[model samples]
Target: MIGILGFVAVFAGGRWLGWAARWVWLLAWGWLLVLLLAHAPYMPPELGAFVGGEFRGWFVLGVLAALALAYRTGLRRLQGRVAPVVAEARPGAFSAVELDRYARHILLREIGGPGQKRLKAAKVLVVGAGGLGSPALLYLAASGVGVIGVIDGDAVEGSNLQRQIIHTDARIGMPKVFSADVAMKALNPFIEVRPYHRQLEEGFAAELVAEYDLVLDGTDNFDTRYLVNRVCAAAGKPLISAAITQWEGQISLYDPTHGGPCFECVFPVRPAPGMVPTCAEAGVAAPLPGVIGAMMAMEAVKHLTGAGQGLRGRLMIHDALYAETRVIGVKRRAGCAACGGG
Candidate 1:
């Protein structure tokens, strides 16, 4: 090549530039020869054909990567849809079999095997630990409600010992809410118990109540009682309201949407301090709270199991000392302060 360039430079009158350009071409051609020799010193026809194939290896890798990503994303979405698991209701760390753990409950015409399992999977939040809360907590926990949340901000006073069957002398100084949780869990290890040892108020109240499937208003005070009820109504949850004072007790279930009045409709606001005396002042019969709270649990279980006619539209009142029970039919108040058109 340099000889040809030299001949051209001699003919065209530029010999020095032609020499430099020929040297560059020689160096590039030498590198190319070295590369091919190192790769395959003696390349056969079949080896050349194999190496010259299209970039399908990279294409196959890309397809596989895309498929793997798609599968991962779909699997994650399915798992998210069924999260926050409820533990299976088989008796663990206990001797009762499936048939025995629920034998008494199953005997009731309302709760069959399917209904019993539904109760096992359901979660219930009881809003107090005083009078009405005592019996409700006991029965629901004993019946194997999978999850039970007790929300209260009080202590186990000596006066509360009679009606609140779950508390004991050792727990007298403990917080009422936490004591209730320990007692309920001890009664049935199959249950998961949570304690809300604070008052349920606006802003922070709805977030806690939203986690559970149903709400039970066993609170003794009026304002907090209405708070739980209205929050449940807003969240489209089933609300079971029970109130007891003096010798009187009432139990009712409300679904805010289906044209039934909510707690706000029943009591527009907290009553004045001395307007209606509390259990302490009016002096309730010792066993009255058990009657009310137990009824509250009953209504909540029925709502969860869908076992029988729910106490959705009717309010039940009980007068134990008088031995009288009354059923009051209630309708959704059109202009209820809390739940009206909300």
Candidate 2:
């Protein structure tokens, strides 16, 4: 009740002060931080202990409860309030069972308990349930990444069973996202899988990508890839893009952590009409996206866990026909356009 009254007083004062308080959002966040710190364990020993031994206990509990309620209420009342930032979902302390189950990953110096925690807290949205999307979804879910969202509007056909490994004969007619969700759940029930069985467009893509920590472009078309890039750029979400054509494939990370080039920076815009042939028209080799898709998944895991150097600012190209690979360095444009000056 005290916390509530204090917040009410501040809000009223802010309103009376008019435009001096530019944003109530910041005011709410500021008050929330103050409340958390006041309820922290830094009080004197007598005030920190439970019972009368700690003047801090009841006060802390009451203030925390009040702050939490106020924070939620203010968010619902504010404009442009986003989902609460969930601490970046990095790894931290672990239970014995998690240690045993993830012994290999935990044993690695790069991805100790903290890194695994981050991975477990990550929410990734895979944009396609087809070729590249299939492998990325499976690997990310199996890796114990906490939440995975699969978005696709297509239905499974008999032909998709070859590369889209998540779908089965029994799920041949099911929506690809729903089918993949079931398979992923079966693989690791511990992970939360959100399946979206609808086509993504401009506004909806913005909203969907905004909710996730990162996005993976498993899509195969120029139009969808452009759409995904625009959405991720606007929403400030990292994006991993992979494409397969004939016997060749490429993977790139449009991550902003390095302040490097985004997918838009590299591709700029879609090629002129007929400038590039579609995989459907040109006939992609069956194993092409599988090999590249798995790599894309690995990059995502590495990124989520901060395990090692990611593909940020670098594009990887592979040609299975000739068994050759190439790496191209990418740089964020100073004034080229798109995300640069935005």
Q: Mind giving the per-residue lDDT tens digits that candidate 2 earns over 1-342?
A: 454555687778778877455475467556655554555677544322322323354456658867987897798878455665332223456556556767888788998877778888889999999988888888998787888998899999998876778889999899999999889878866678899989888767887887899899978778888888877776678899998888999999996545867787887767888777877678788888889989988999898888788898899999999999999998776654557722
RMSD of 1: 23.3
The list of candidate 2 runs beyond 4 A from truth reads 1-97
Whole-model lDDT, model 2: 0.79
TM-score of each: 0.70, 0.70
Instruction: Estimate every model's Cα lDDT from 0 to 1.
Output: 0.77, 0.79
Candidate 1 global CA lDDT score: 0.77
lDDT of 1 by residue, 1-342 (tens): 332343344435534446565465455445334333333536565543443322343345446756986898899999999966443445333335546878888888878777777887888998888888888999999888888888888889887897788898889989998888888877776778889888788978889988999989887778787778878888888889888888888888888777677877766667888987878778888889988888888888888888778778788989887899989887777678678843
Candidate 1 wrong stretches, greater than 4 Å: 1-96
Residue 41's lDDT in candidate 2: 73
RMSD of each: 23.3, 21.1
Alpha carbon deviation, residue 168, candidate 1 (Å) = 0.6
- Worst 10-residue lDDT window for candidate 2 reads 46-55
